[model samples]
Target: MTTDHRTHARVAVVTGGSRGIGRAVCERLAQNGLAVVVNYARDAAAAKETVATITAAGGRAVSVQADVADENAVTALFDRAEQEFGGVDVVVNAAGRLALSPIADLDLEVLDAVLRTNLRGTFVVAQRAARRLRAGGSFVAFSTSVVATRFPAYGAYVASKGAIESITLILARELRGRDITVNTVAPGPTATDLFLDGKGPEQIEQLAKAPPLERLGTPQDIARVVAFLTSSEGHWINGQILRANGGMV
Candidate 1:
């Protein structure tokens, strides 16, 4: 079981837990003995399926529907966690939107939509997590290695994640004595719908080659890193961006 400062069973609220890497994190944390609050913006079916999988494994979980960008909705999301599992100890802000277009040609509307979900949503969730997570808790945000790679057609998506890295670092300092660790996990070319959606097979192969591991990362791979970051063993690691990219740099 994961260790809480109080040595009680910990609770986690994983935004975007309906599928992909977020779903993997929820499942892994549940296996580690943390009660999970699975948050989904729209995919209620997927969220319910995730909860069912957890419960079937003898893990406690409840699916919650909320747009991470909506303050009132996010507030209710956290309330459900508290009411169902006592209190929250970990929050993994995994909700994000990806749009591919060069900055010059990107529509302003598309930019707004990306920022609304990836940036504003992060802020809303982080604000609530900062206030709710118990001592010795953790808040992990998501970023992309593309922020460093400077990939073309990823302008809006990268901007949102770049802002997230800044928020993660500064918030770790802002929560100084609260004993809550805030960090970002920047993954490289993972094999998830979010990463594979529009890419061609050749492009995927080329990305898979960049990593010394010589393959695309699985959602489970990224989830394991998150599992550590939110656990007592990794609590000392704070205000850092861990790139779980198989040495892709």
Candidate 2:
């Protein structure tokens, strides 16, 4: 769906774009006039639906399936974007896995699965983006506000996102002179399935209140920040972990 009509608009490849924050980011980027490549791991139906919604609104979009941890797959993801659109200007690695468990009783297998997706997947996508993104492009990865809050039972999840934050700056510095921006969006208590799953109303209420804004961050809230980061206006802001948690930190 490279029919963006607007020649000045850029292109974006978003992993996990089928659902949740990724989906929201795709729509927002489209509204900002960027042609979107919606990448999904397994949910082809959802991915197609996302593409349909965007295209229905006169936005250019296409769906592609790729496991974020697979280097070749992500490489092909970028290839698909370039094949559809002219070039890639923005890459958002919103695909992540979260498992909350106290370290004392941590399951090694669970840890491995979480890290495999959240860590290795991020790196694979970033590696491809590093190679494929055009000059002045930006990459935004996902992290968690819990990295600062240090909540219990979040050891595994926080550890993975923590590693993401650590690598983001190095990647940014490494991309010097390329004019690419690499940053992480560390959201806090976002109102998405990933955050709400397995949590009760009471827990949800507590988290909502934890933020000074007194509400769980909507997918759109975080989406807008990502939209800005990928835009030319945000090019000056590079190599930073933006806590889009509504003051949860």
Candidate 3:
């Protein structure tokens, strides 16, 4: 696709946009003529690099540091976006952390952190977006294929994403009078740094082969779908969970 930079671009705020899927989503939105507010939790340097990448490519972008789990920080993030880009047209909640352990072995601290970051964080961000979305705005949240497959050791993560899916529906109805759409993108096992750890080449190969496509997904693959969902073309889709997992069940 061609990247046509515009003088006055639409505004978008993306969480966890410093690396991996978040970075790709930011780049794709920028290429599609949107000024991106790239939000990061702790990786300021990486977030800056993402912003630089977009700017160098003739697209507009800025890096903002905010922990999604914190309501104050999330409020600050939206305030900064509005101050910088006028008003936000698209909001993507892709910032999340994954911890895998059997329910028996799970630590309360780990569970709490996961819930705060994945569940509470999404609520805060989505609520903020719902309040500020433009007339035809869009809100995209993230889920995982593990929710469907019920993968062992993923109970906590799945529970969080399940909450995300439920919230998407609730928020969509809550905004019935508005033209905005709220949805979820549930990606299957992709070839991301977060998904590749503790696994070797053979393990990676096995995971990739599990998908019908015979390969793991790339960040770009997911980003393209997200771009469409937030763009004018996807305006008709609302309160849906579109899974981009290379056809993995």
Candidate 4:
């Protein structure tokens, strides 16, 4: 494995790191020489595969499982990072759930589930990162560009993500003088399983064509943006919502 030659190896804890955008983030950060802690909710196998991929690529990584909505589990996640990697410098809260239905027909239980994972999860993870991240650290949360699209049948999901965008600025301000940055990435339609699920071929084609780029976003596309925001070069960008869409607004 290629070792980071820096005075100290930077460590990152990435939620939902077992798959999709989270997996891409883990890989990118590892490539950047950060020791990564890959957090998955239920898929231990996928998590293991993620770690294996990194290790095979000569990067350092480990997998930990936690439901982002659970306070104790999240606390333990951070504790594990400190125990294993010395300290945490980057936290990416990418664990989330999506439930689509018109507001009138949406099941309250489904709405609750979506909020619990997406909104509550973001808050829980953010709180822990705010408390534990070292100076010069960063907390990157995931928000959806659908909040701007206002597409039908996305009321609950949009509502949850909207909450994330609303609190991002406040949280950044709350960490004043900490030398830490907090930002949310609001991505347009990306071709992850999460986005592709329930979408028919026709609908997917329509979305791919809607963006000026005339294509769907890959997970790596989003990860590059996340990596930049958490890197030293992006230190000055704070308390902002970066829309990583290809002119899909």
Clashes of each: 0, 0, 0, 0
Q: What is the C-alpha RMSD of each candidate to the true structure, in Å?
A: 1.1, 2.3, 1.9, 1.5
What local distance difference test score does each model get? 0.94, 0.92, 0.91, 0.94
Which regions of candidate 4 are displaced past 4 Å? 1-6
Clashes of 1: 0
Candidate 4, lDDT over the whole model: 0.94
Residue pairs of candidate 4 with colliding backbone atoms: none
Q: Is 1 or 3 the stronger prediction by lDDT?
A: 1
**How high is each candidate's TM-score?**
0.98, 0.96, 0.96, 0.97
- lDDT (Cα, 0-100) at 33 in candidate 1: 90
Model 4 lDDT tens row, 157-215:
99999999999999999999999999999999999999999999999999999889999
TM-score of predicted structure 4? 0.97
lDDT of 2: 0.92
Model 3, runs deviating above 4 Å: 1-8
Q: How many clashes does the backbone of model 2 have?
A: 0
Worst window of 10 by summed lDDT in candidate 2: 1-10
Error of 1 at 42 (Å): 0.8
Off by over 4 Å in 1: 1-6
- The window of 10 residues in a row where model 4 has the poorest summed lDDT is 1-10
